[model samples]
Every structure is written in structure tokens, then in C-alpha cells.
Target chain A: MEENSKLSQFQPVKSIFEINREERMAPGHRACAGCGPMIAVRQILQSLDVKPVVISATGCVEVTTSTYPDSAWLVPWAHVAFENSAAVASGVEAAMHALKVRGELKEERPVIALAGDGGTFDIGLQALSGALERGHRMLYVCYDNEAYMNTGIQRSSATPFGAWTTTSPVGKEWPGKAEIKKDIMGIVVAHGTPYAATASISHWKDLMTKVRKAVSQNGPTFLHVYAPCNRGWRFEPKDTVEVAKRAVETRFFPLYEVENGRYRITVPVAKPRPLEDFLSLQGRFSHLLKPENLEVLKELKSIVEERWSKINAAASVQVQT
Target chain B: MAQFEPVQTRKSLLTGDEAVAHAVRQSSVDLVAAYPITPQTIIVERIADFAASGAFTGQFVPVESEHSAMSACIGGALAGARAFTATASQGLALMHEMLYAASGLRLPISMAIANRALNSPLNIHNDHTDVMGSIDSGWIQLFVENAEEAYDRVIQSFRIAEAVNLPVAINLDGFTLTHSTEPVEMLSDEVVRGFVGRPPKRDSLMDEAPKSFGLMSLPDSYQFFKDDQSRATTGSSVTISQVEGEYAKLSGREHGPLKIFRPGSKVMMVMLGSYAGTARTTARRMKNDGEQVGVISLGWLRPFPEKQFLDALEGVETLMIMDRSVSYGAPAGPLASDVMSLLYRYGIKRKVIAVTYGLGGRGFLEEDAMRLFRYAGKSGSSFESFFFYGGE
Candidate 1:
């Protein structure tokens, strides 16, 4: 496990410039500066070779693109209610099938569903589960910011343990968010999706490659992308990618994929940068300077490392994604 | 004595539910998220048989619950497949969340609701309560009266839904219409093809590339998405009538959002589903002896068709809103409340009375319809009236 953790981070280059400068996400939009989700989408769309239909929930991505008719999206797009993006997308995909079987749509054009942590982890899970179970050739990409950023950054199931959201504020022996982040990728994999991967913005190349593989490969593909938030995490605008990279280096967010049933690490940040090296840069962990606080944070990193090792092992337990 | 016009190329004997199933097959819907309940079982059963016999290539998910049924349907639809689903009564009620989701996304899809009264004490019979329960879920709802209308309406639903890029539900009474077999002029494959036509665009949510369909929404985006949904559904509200008009050009039978059977009567009785047919029967009896009674069959329920309804009811001195559902509390039953609300909004307040009929879907027979017309004749302000017809 130690040897695997130190493996060099995988980087795929051709996908980077392969993206069209004419972004599917148009230029004029309503997003905060250095928005991680939008950047993740940009990298993702770069990998897609076809004009895809985009379904988004009522989140930051949705608000930014569709604001009173002037959509920032260059592609055909729709924004459904918060909890049913998966369901709404399901209808669109079904319609396409009907059209194709009866000779309506050509055998091309990919469909993708983009959701936030709150939508995928909490409200929209049932619909997502059904979509994966149906085995429709669609990809579900969750831009995880760890909280409900669109709804004022409230704590969600995806919120990591000890993170301080408004609700999980740092106070009186309270360690902010109490529970560990829900391993949603596991739940998605349980649905028997053909492809599942955990990626982050720190590794844009890896993210894009996995996305391409996900959509091109048959059946349902799920890409859980860790996107850092400047506002949510109280980090500098320029540190979005830096913080993401630190996350992987400190073993907070590991890059891996579950194909069929086998697990493969796209980029193993196993050499392990000290947890302090990552936390010192973020305002969210400012209070962790106390010696005892540092101990707890170290414990958290240990948990993340242990979890990744098991995940890597479990990936090999299954095959044929 | 029978005379044949030979207007339709083909005909078939079937129930309303069977017609709906056949129409689903003819349309080649990709997935069916079905939650089978009584009287509505045949629709799913026939479709299931079709799938089993290698007839339909789509996935017909037999969901454990109505919520899951809609969930599966939505998933398949998102994957860029033609989808269909059926539900009734408690099952329809169970799919409450998904109903809003399906419409809010503005997906061009269709559903068949075997309308039945909801239960507390438990009853599985024909009524509008089930469909009425979710009438405001932003769907383009079309109520059908007979087997022929049911079949024709199912096909028309797809056109209406696809044209406006909205979800549509074809509502019909449970056993009253769904189980009652009747002669229906089933369209031949060629004529049906000519009328329905293929999907104009194949812009599926699913393509081979990395395109995302449905995504989670936040507060910053929920309202705008909802606004778009409302626009599409309301647009469909108007478009459905036009689709029906065009359908009439080819099928020779038509129904609209607000189909005014006989307007300009001093008194009018409104109804939906199979009860509309009975209400029309009762209206004719009442009008024969100059009773000044007429019937209005409501089809598209969501947009409410405010101006159209007000105009139809303007000449009438008295308006009786008869619904086959209960609202539990407040004044009028579901239909009556919506009508009165519309009238009040338009500042055209006439003598409007409300009454609830067919609780648990016992029956909305001709006598019940006559009784409602008679009640409309005798002007009263019993806004929360429940009629226990022919009780011991």
C-alpha cells in the first residue's frame, strides 16, 4: 500500500489542448471568479468529441449558464429542478432512443448529467441510481465542492468530516462537520455501472482522460470530480488548483477508477505530503494550528489514506467495466 | 342497423387501457417505468408481454413502488431513450416528487394515468382523484372519455409533449373506461405513421460523447429552471389544443384543453374522464326539456385555461363544478376550487357552486351526472358539498 501511494501522478496531455477554445460553456456567465465546478466542466467538455446534450440541476453551473434566456452554454442544454436532474435527463435520453430506434437521431451525440455534491449525494441519488441501473449509455459527472455552494454553502452528505460550513461552524468542542464524507462512488458502483472514477481538478489531464473513457466506453459511467471552492474553503482565488493538488498530495482526495469491477489508480499521490503542508494554506483549517487540532487533522489524513488503500484493493475484486 | 364510413383504415376491439398500451407500442417508446395497480395493470401487463415476446426493444422496469417507477422512467429518458409509464390511485400519489421532476425538466415524454379515487378506507374504482391529485405538478394532462379517445389521446399526447418539449399524462377513469371494452377505430401502421410522424429531431440527452443530461440544481438556479418549465408547460397548454385540431384533420376525432360540448347555457356542469361522457349524457337529458344545462369536459388541467374557461362559463347563470376527488379541507373539491379560483382571479364571479362525487371511485353513473346537473339547476352556495349518491 505504501509503495502504491508513492506512484507518480498520471498525466494525459493530448486532452488538454484537444479542447475547443470555443467552450461549450460560453464566455459571458454568472459565476464567481475561479469557480472550480466550471473549470472542471471545461476540462470535461474538452474530452467529449460530440455535440452533447447537457442537463444540470439548480446549482451554480445551472445559475451561471441559464440566467433569463441568455445561456452561457454553447451546447443544447436544460436546467431542471434541484433533485431530479437525473430524472429529467432520463426522459431526454429515452426520447433520443425512441427517435434513434425509429430513425430519428443518428448514432452519435453523447448525453451527460452534471450535478453538485448536494444533488448527487443527497437529493438526486435515487434518480442517479436508477439511471446507472438502467445501463443507458450516459455519463454522470458530480462536481464535488463538499457542500451545497449554490444554497449558501450549507453542509451536505458530501461535506468532509471536520469541515466548517455555516451550519457546522467551529465552536465549543464542535469539530465542524461531524461525519465522514459519504463514499458516493461506492454507492454508484454498487449499481453496477460499467465505469466509475474519482478525479480532482489538481489533475485536470487525468480528469479529462477519465471523462473521455467514461462516455466512449459503453453503459453508465460515473466521474466524481473533486473541485475546490475559493469561497467555500476560504482559500485564495489562485490557490484553487494549488489546494486541489495539495489535497491529492496530502492524500485527502486520491485519483482512482473502478472499471467493471477492478480498481485502478489514475494518479497515486502515495508519497504523502504532510497534512500540515496542505492545511496551512487554507483558512478552513486555520483553527487547526493548536497541537491537539493538528493531531486530529493528522488522524483524518490517516483515515483518508487507509480508505484509499482498501478502495484500490476492492477495485481488483471486480472486473469487466 | 349500421352504416360504415370507411374513414379509418383499421379498427380493433379494445378497452381504454389496451388502446393506450397499443399506442405506446406503435410509437416505439424506449422505456416504460410502470408501477402496476388494479385496473391499470393491463396496460403494464400487455406492455410487459410485448417486451417478453421480443416485440419492444426498450426496458420495461417493474419497479417496487411508484416512486421507483418514475425514477426508472426518468433515468431511461435521460439516457436518450423513448420512455412510457403507467400508474393509478395510491401509485400515482407515490410518484409525487417525480411528477414535478419529469415536467420541470421539460422532457418530451408521455404517461398513461388510469385515473382512480385515492383511498383512506380503501377503494379501487374509477374517479379523477388520482390524476387530480397531481394536476398541478406542471404536466400537460389530457383527460380521455372512451376507448377510442383514450387511444387517440395517447398518440396525441406524444405530439403535444414533443411539440412543446414538455411531459404529458393521458388521464382516463380506471374500470369505468380502462376495463370496459368498446369498438375503437385503430389506425393502420401507415396512417398512424402519416399522422404521428417520426420525431423531428434526435437531439437525445445521451450521445456517444461526454454530454451531461440532468444535473443537480441550487437555489441560484432553481427558479430560472422552474420558470423555463412553466413557460414550456404553459406553452404546451395552448399548443395541445392546436395539436388536437391537427389530429382532427387526420383522425376525424379531437379533444382540446377546454372542450366546450355545448356552451351558452344558463347553467353548466363540468366533469372529466369517463364521467364527462356520462355528464354529457345527463346534460342532453336535462337540455331536452329546456333545462338550460350543458356539459364542459376538461382536458388540459395544469395551465387551467383561465380565459377560455371564463368565456365558456360567462353566459351561464349558474356553474356547477363536479369533481371526482376530495380536497380533505377548505371549500371546494380539487376541480371546483381551481375553477372558482380562476373565476375569482378574472373578476367574473357568477353563481358558482362546488361538489365532490365518487369518493374511492364507487361510480359516477348517468344518475350521478343527472343529479349534479339538477343541483346546478337549483342554485346554492354549498362550496364544500359531498354527494352520497344512492346510499342506503
Candidate 2:
């Protein structure tokens, strides 16, 4: 949900052929079970329509796809290192612009990247900040699953409160490791990006729709989409998207967009479900079923409700203006 | 009638910076991602003026920081354009992270790191630490001793970098060579046109066709990626000589790895950059005394002229390394350490003396250079004038 884009009411494309289908992320990649990110990535490539230069940081998507001579990618790619994806992308854009101006360029292309939670939240944040400040025409997709799932299930800054990963496992004295997830979406919006959105595999159409919005516009755009990891969550493989849908329905992971300085929830909460509906499916939250812990969990759900209300109220005020 | 040589010559007097810019300008370099740092600033400033005035047809991107400067240059190079930039001292250090990225990908990116000392409290002076720190990044490093060479080497860099299909750096001492403008006789436009032609590759990425650059490499394939880069860089020495030779043929002035200013002398001072002139003057003085002193100026620093250096120092008992910057906590200067490290491999364990001198942009006078020759120790000494500055 990109509030600014919602407010503008996106205009229709000029041509059907240019329906945004640059297959920078070619099909047939080997990701894990319940990996919502690969779906999100596939939809993004479908929307671009033009070939895009991709600079990927280290993490699951990169490791799984780039396995030597047999890459899941059909595009010509160079993988530098984790902390430098943003830096490397900046170089590609600069090089492309130079070549085009001198008539040395044979084609015109869009440059973007797919960065994971570890890459975006930890190692590559500084480079990302620099890229935004420089105003490169790039779209960065942060596929965040709230934890470091690739490396034996560890806690990350994006991991939610009261979640149980290897580092945040449940214990007799405490109800799993505790701490709230950082407001990464807010940070991107604060950077004053032209387009910023939070989407989830829960709303596939909305997630793919925002990807189109981001690439068409100039300057830097960031999309932080929620991904569910079944291995880490101890859930059945098939319930991945359904779990995500439940999280959104319960308003735990709200689907929304933030653009320029406005905010808008892309998929309105027509029927906000109970938080327990979203929690019961995953084993990570099984411990919360205990009486006292359940009460504490209810308090957390109420906090999410209260936060979404304020955001909705803000959007309504903007609509009034 | 004598046979007439129809020569295509571009002969004009220019500052070292202008000469270098003219070479690149002729190369039709499409992008320049450089910051305004001392010594090197002149090269970029002149380029900025040229780009702004439409004297050259290219994009002059004013990056926010040195990190972005190098970052942007890498992008442009990867996109398949002849990309270039310039920096000095702290600016070079700031770009340290991007250096590995550029070389690791084997992008034909070119940068001029005006040799300057890195800072703690802050000192803006000439030193090799900035470039020396980047020695292992796998860039082809070329050192120029004066304004004329600065112009010449930058021109040759594009050829060497593109030839090796790797990034290249042309290092010149700050202020000494950069700020101090001398009459640089640029080759004719025809000569430059004949020298640096267009790039072979087109824009590597386009909207119609996407490509992945700087992608993630796993442990399984990391060694091969680096090995490929090594092969590309090591293969550059041959192209470097070829390009330098062509440029020399066109301009009638020769320069390359271990280019001998005066060959076959009993005692020779080996060095690079502005101080080389001072050494030559002292060699002239020492030669008059029948001591057989001479000077050997090495233009290429990274793919060092080991064979030639060994040959130059063969008969000489004392090989002096005139280091302008110290390596700090090391036994000798960075260049000396490199020389010593290779001495056993090259089998030239001659008495190579180390001398650290002329830091923070201090002047390295002829008198100071003469003192090293007076010692007859064959080992180089630091320029001692920095200690006795501001005297009555």
C-alpha cells in the first residue's frame, strides 16, 4: 500500500505489450518450502516488462539462485558481495547512463535489486541510504520474513516480538525471546522516497500491483513485503500464504502503502479477524496458548489494532484534505 | 628530396591535469564520477569545466561523497562505458570499499588517486599510502613523476584498463605533480584519435534485456571469480607495454614499466613522480664527479618491472628507494617492503636503502636529494627538510 500512489489513482499503461515483463529474475529458482519471496520476485519481474539490471546482496534468494554455471537466472549477472549490492547497482546505473549518452549503449534498461532482511536491515543499510540520497532510478525489494531463516533460524531486527527462533527459543522462565521489530517501512518513508510500500504474499495482487507502481516512476523506490518461512515457524508447508493472509486479516501484518508524505492501507480491513486465528497455525507461537501468556498476547494484538486505527485515521484526514 | 613523414600530431602546452583530461576527452569517456580533492581536483575541475562548457560531450556527475564517486564510476563501467574519476588522500580512503567492488567485477574503470597521506588529526600532503592501501584490490597502478607524465599516463591507463578488462589507477603525488602546473605538450588530436579508440562492448544492460551485475557469489564459486580477475590483471602487462609503446611512437616520448631515464650507471636512484626530477639533477651532479650515478624512473607500479629493475640495479651495489610516505610500524616504506618481498623472488638482494621524506605537501629540494648521494650508503633516506622547516 503506497499511500501517495493511492492518492494519485494510478493511470493506465499506454500499451499492452509494455506490460512490465523484464525477466531479470528468470524462473525455476531453488528456494525453500513456504518461501513467499520467490513468488513476490516473480510477480515483480512480470510487471517491469523491460530487462532490469539486478544487484543482489547475500542471503537466501541469492544463494539458492546463483549456483555456478547453472543459475536460475537467464540474465547476464555479476554478483559482487553482500554489503555492496547497492553500491554495485549505483555503478551499473552510472555506467548505463554514460554509455547511453555517448551512443555506446545499444539498449535502455531499468536497474533494480532484490535484497533480503539481513542485507537490507543489517549489512547493506548504509549503502541503501546512500543510494536513496543520490536519487538513482532503482527499485529495491526487501523480502523480510522477520528473521534470519537461511542460517539455522536466528533472530534478526525484523523478527517480531514473542517469536521463537533458535536465538529466541521458548524457555520455562520466559515466553520466547522478546523485542519489537524495527520500523523499516517508516525509515524508508522518512528517507523521502517517491514511492514506498508494504505488501505481503497475503495480497498477491496488491503486492504485484505496487511493484509496477515502483518501477514506472523515477528515483528510488522500496517495497518491504512480508514473507513466511515454514521451517522456522514449524508449520505445514502448504499453509504459507494462508498464514500470511490470516496475519493481514487479523491486522498483525497490515497491507499498506506510503508515498511521498501520505499513508494509505491498500487492502482495507473489511473483516478484521481475531489475532489467535493468525497465531495458532505456527508452532513458534504454541507456547503463548498458556493462560497468562495468552493474556499478554492479547495485549500485543490490541496494540497492533490501535496502531492501524491511527494510520487509518491519518489516511482519512488526508482524504478529507 | 628527403622522404616526408605525414605525422598526425596533437601538440599543445597544457598543465598535467589538462593533458590528462585531453587524453580522456579524446577517448570520449562518457561518465566521470570524481570529487574535488587536492592535487587531483585540478584534473576533475578542468574536466568539470570542459563538460559544463560542452567542450567535451559527457556526463559530469557531482557525487555527494567519495564513496558514491567510486560507486557511480563502477556502475558506469559495468554498464559498458569508458568510465573515469579522480581523488586524493582521505577521499581515496573513503572510496576504499568501492575499489574492491570495481576490481572484483573486472570493470574497465579508471581512477586517478593523486598520491596523498591519510589523516588522523588531519594532514593534506603527498604520500603513497592512499594508493598503496589499494595495492591488493587488483587494480593496475601507474605512478607519474611530473605533470607531463601525469597527462601521458592517464591517457595510457584507459588502454591498459580496457586491454586487461580490469580497473586501472594512475597515481600522481599531490601538489608536487597535480597543483604545480607545468607546460604539458599534448599530442595532436589526430594522434589522440589514433591512440585511444572506442570501447568494444556496448551498454551491458538495457530495458529490453536485463543483466545481473555484482550478484552474490557463494563459497562454491568465489575462488573461480577471483581467479578469473587475477588472470585478467596479470595479462595486462603486455597490453600496457603495447599501448605505451604506441603512444611513445606517436608522441616521440617513451614511458612504461621500468623506463630507464639513463641506463647503465655504477650507482642509480630508482623512483617515480615529481621527486624523480630532483634525483635526476643530483645524478647529474654525482655523474660530474665520475661516480657514474644515474636514475631509473618506473612508470607502472602495480605490475612492477621486476626484470628491468633487476637489470637496472645489476651492477649497482646501492639501490635507493626514495619513499615520500612511511608505512608506519613497518620496517620500511610500502614500496620498499614490496621491493624486499620480491628481492628473493627476483634474485636481486642488492642494498636497497629506504628513505621516508616530503610528507604533508612539504617541498623536496635538490639539496635534500644531494644529501642522500653524499651518504654513499646506496640506501635511500627520508627527505630531512620536513623536520627543519620555517627556519630563519
Candidate 3:
């Protein structure tokens, strides 16, 4: 009678419980301590319940997850050449479609491509654009760490202005990066894809939401996640999340999503903090602190404001439509 | 022993490119990703027509570049689909990086290369430069002499590649064979499909196996993996011969790694691709003129075919190797270099001469083969200087 009563007590809990909870990106990976891209990758992968075939470019994520004879990915993954991840994903998607048509495959699988900023914004832009224009059913995620972190912190087009990268070092004739960051989100939107979004590692809930939304779409979808680099940005390893938070609070990286050619800013900062609060913590922008380089800081701030205003105008038009 | 008789096949007149298209259609290729390049464009064009007409049940991806084409093939193959593509000289060069990735991942993708000259003076003509340049890219290369061989090898390539778990490249001379129409004994779709069978059920990314491919390898493990790949390629000779034998049983046309004519001759010429046809005709004429001459055409460029080459060259006093592409600063051209290496390894010393000709679509005729063979047969002639035919 006591054993029956105990079994009756456990029945209610079992009714409310869900089984088979597993993490797709496993632990024991080679990512550094407090790696922001690793955090973004984890959160984004967790957003998908279905197993995805991951195609990665040659970057920190690929190098860390897949070392020779060992793999950290629990899901199926492939790392092709650096500049052809999207193209490879396009092929995989086509193959899946063909298999389904031929009745060789029964279950549908999502294809996800993970690339670094150097791959997405610079070298792999053409391939990515081709995939997007062709309407491949896949999701491409760019973990934007600002610079080429895998190749030792070289400057990429995604690197912001007034930042010191290996190739954009402060010298007598030059002051850090002379050009502003390339508007990669705008370029992706111009492809007229079904979905495109920008998220940051600090906003885990918002990033995962965007990931789920992107995956739900049928056509090509892109999500650009702002990932802070602790080593490359010259910050304490423990302050990785703190750095990423500051980047969002300062309006340096905005949170927005574009669905079906309509824009919506998800995280709108009512009062953005000064950009200096984010820059002063990272040694990459220490040169901008000099009084002689005050103009560069002003230029950076103006570019940020100009971008925010343009996004706001676009969102308003979308709302009106 | 009974003499082998050719099978009665359904004959059709087709170009090399058309033959390749027919083979792709006949084989159960699930996907084709390709970019249009000169001399190889007709292949994809015909494939597109077939796809549009609902004759071919596959996905034809018109990629933006050859790099993407090969990249897509890698993806499709990783997804456990039979993938195929075709390209020419510049297109092949553009796909150089992905070529290693395909072979390294063991994708078993088949590519048809319409062999053309590489650029610098931008010529779209027949040469071995494209395929020769990629000899070290870890693909099993088969050079065809005509449309019939091109069709047969394309079907045979899929079987060999999937059996050995490697990529195969079927190379035919650009304008010479790709544009010229010839009578080809084509196999029926059912026969070809039965011969190719289904793709081997390997662990692919599309399956539920959750496997990871193309991982980064450190110095400690990189060499071992590369050595394993080398072993797979070197050990594929038996698989190639077996598949060719099986294909012959179905098609009644025998295609071997090496084709020898007039064996055990005093003077012999070795060549690859369509030039072999002209060389064979020249050698037969020389034999009729009471001159002991012969020709050996190499169908398999990779795996070197050392034993077959040695067996064909036995008792030959002099060898004239016809190369359409130069090795540039080496003692001989690419084919001759491998032949010379084999001779040195086996301690067989023979008078060897390399005649590089037909580059940039310059014609290589029967007269040229006769001249080279006669030059090789004459005594007291130094083989020090490599002969460059039809050049200023």
C-alpha cells in the first residue's frame, strides 16, 4: 500500500516532464575561456530542436570544434574551404531536395552555415550572395568578431573605425582603421531574402529568438551575431560578456530583424551610453583616447548616429507599409 | 583462347561533350552543379535540355563559378547523392582549392574535364595542360582517345570512384574530341544504371550518423591521413581494372588502363588523349612499311600504371614520348618524367626522347607522329634537346 502511494505521487511529475533533452554543441571544445562566439554558437544551436547539417568556414569555430580525429559537434558537420561555406550549404540543400523528390530521403533537415566576418563580408560575399539570390533553403550565421581572429587579429571589412588591428595599427601616418565598418546587414537585405537579422551574444534570448525565426523560414535566412573577442580586443578573459553587453548598450551594435522586406528594431535603446564606455575597456581603441585623435572618436559617434537614424527611418517606412 | 568480339551496341553519332552528357543522363546521377566554360559548355547545355525535358530526374545547379560548382559537388556528395560536373582549363584552375577538399573528404564525385590549354595568351584549344596541371590534386584521372571511350569511361568512372571512395576525372582533348563528331556505341540507360548500381552507402553528413568531415589536422595526424589517402589511390589499380572488366562484360567494349598496339617493337611512342589515335595510325603505317614501330596510349594517368607501361615497353630499344604540355624547366614533359622515373626505378636503361607538341590547339597530325618515331628510330641522334613541335 505504501509503494502504490509512492508511485501515485510520481505520476503527476512525469506527466509534466519532457524527455530527451540533449545539447547539440557538446562541451570539451577547444574554445578559449569566455569566448563570445562560442557562447553565440551554443545559444543559436540550442534554438533548433531538429538536428541540422552544419557547414562551417575555416575560422575559430571550425578549428575549435573539429580537431583531428576528434569532434565537439554532436550533430552532423562539414567544414569546407574558407570562402565556400554558403556555396557548400547551397549544394547540400539542393541534394536534400533532390533526395526528397526521388523518395530517397523521408525526413527534412535544416542546413546551417557558420562563417566568420572575414568570410561573410569579404572573401565569401559572392558565394553568399549567389546562394541567397538562388533562394536556397538554408540559414547562414556570421559570428562577427570584428576582425580575423583565427589568423591573428588581422583587419577585416567588418572591423569598426578607430580600432587597432594587426594590419590597421596606429602609426605616424595612419590612425588605427581609417574606414568605417562595412554595412553587411544592408548588403544581405539587398539580396531580398526572406529573413535577415542582427543579434549580439549579450542578448541570448533575443539571439535565440532570431535564430528560431530564421530557421522557421523556408528560403535563405541570415543572422549576423556580434561576438566580442577577449584576446583580440585586449580585455580580461572574464569580462567577455561584459564587453559584449557594453557594445549593445552603447548602440555600437544594434539588435534588429528584417522579415519579408520589413524591418523591426527589436532592442531599442532609449538612451544610449557614450561609445567611450565600450571603447575604453578594449585596448584596440586605446589610441582614440588621445586628445589629438578626438576627431576620430567624433567621427565614429557620428557614423553610429547616422546608421541608427537610417535604420529607424527604414523601420518607420516598413511600419507604414 | 577465344578472341573477344565487340558487343552489338546502339550506335549514335555524338561529340565528346554530347557523349559525356549522355553518360551523365544514363548514370543515376542525383545532382549536377556546373559553370559554363568554353569547350565544356555544351555538356552542361545538353544536361540542362535533358533536365528541362524531364528526361533526367536530378537537380541541375547552375553555379556562378567553377569554385562554387566543385564546392556544391562536395556538399551534394557529402549529403549522400551521386554528384557530377564538367569544366575546362580555366574552370579547372578555378576549382583547384576545392579539388583537394573533395578528395580529402573522399566524396567520390565525378568530374569531366574537356582538356584545354591554360591561359597567358588566352587560347581555347586542345591540350593536356588542364588535366596535367591537376595530376597531383588527388583525383583518379582517365584520358580518353575518342567519343566511345569518353562515354565508356564516364560510366566506368562512377563505379571505380565509388568503389575506391575517391573522385574521378575523365579527361578528353578540348576542341579535338569535344567538338568533333564521331560514332559512339552508347549503352542503354538500364544497362548503365545496372552497371553503376547505387552509390555506396557510406557515412554521409545527410544521414543520422552525425559524422563530421573535413576536420582540421595537426602535424602529428596530418601526414598519416595523407598517407592513407595516397595508399587508397595507389591501391585503386585493381579496382579500376575490375570495374573496367565488369563494364566490358555489359557493354562488350573493352577499355583498359593502357592500350598497346604492335607490342614488342624496336621503336615505340607513348601518348595520351586523342593524339593516341593519330599515333596509332602512324605506327600501323610504319609497320606496313617494314619498320618495327608501335604505340602505347595511357588511359589512366594516375596510379602511373607502372607495370602495364613496363610490360608494353619491354624489348623496345628507343621510346618517343609525345607530350602536349611541358613541365617547364624539367628534363622532360610531365608524362615523360613519370616514364623516366619508372625506368630508373626498375633499372631499365633505354634511349628516351620527349616531343612536346599541339599546345594551344596547334595541330598534331599523323605526319608529326611519323616524324617523331622516325627521329627516335634513327641511330646517332642525341635526345638531349626536347623537341618543341609547331612553335615559333
What is the per-residue lDDT of model 2 for residues B1-392, given as tens digits with 9 covering 90 to 100? 22212223444455566667766676678788777887677777777777766766766767667876787777677667778988888898888877888888777888887888888747777767677778888888888877788778887888878777788888877766666657777776566767788776543655334455555567888999988887777677888889888889877877768656557665566676777887798778777767666777778777776776777765666666766666768877877777777786766556666666666666767776677666644435322212222101
Query: Which scores higher on TM-score, 1 or 3?
Result: 3
User: How would you class the docking of model 2?
Assistant: acceptable
Chain A TM-score of candidate 2 vs. true chain A:
0.89
Candidates' lDDT values, in order?
Answer: 0.74, 0.73, 0.87
Where model 3 places Cα greater than 4 Å from the true spot, the runs are A1-21, B1-9, B379-382
Better of 1 and 2 by lDDT: 1
Q: Could you tell me the lDDT of residue A15 within candidate 1?
A: 51
Tens-place lDDT per residue, model 3, A16-131, is: 12212578888899999989899888877776667888999999999999998889998899999899999999889888888878788876588899999999999999899989
lDDT minimum window of 10 residues, candidate 1 chain B: B1-10
Q: What count of clashes does model 3 give? A: 0
Clashes of each: 46, 41, 0
For model 3 the local lDDT of residue B258 reads 89
Cα lDDT tens digits, model 2, A1-321, are: 111232233433344464555554655677886677776666666655444667667778777887665576655555666665676677676666666666656544666767878778877787788777777777888988777877878888887778888998888765675777777887787889888888887676787778777876667889998888888877898998998899889888888887777888888987889888888998988877778687658666777888688778867888889
Best lDDT goes to which candidate? 3
RMSD of each: 6.8, 6.2, 6.8
The numbered model that scores best in DockQ is: 3
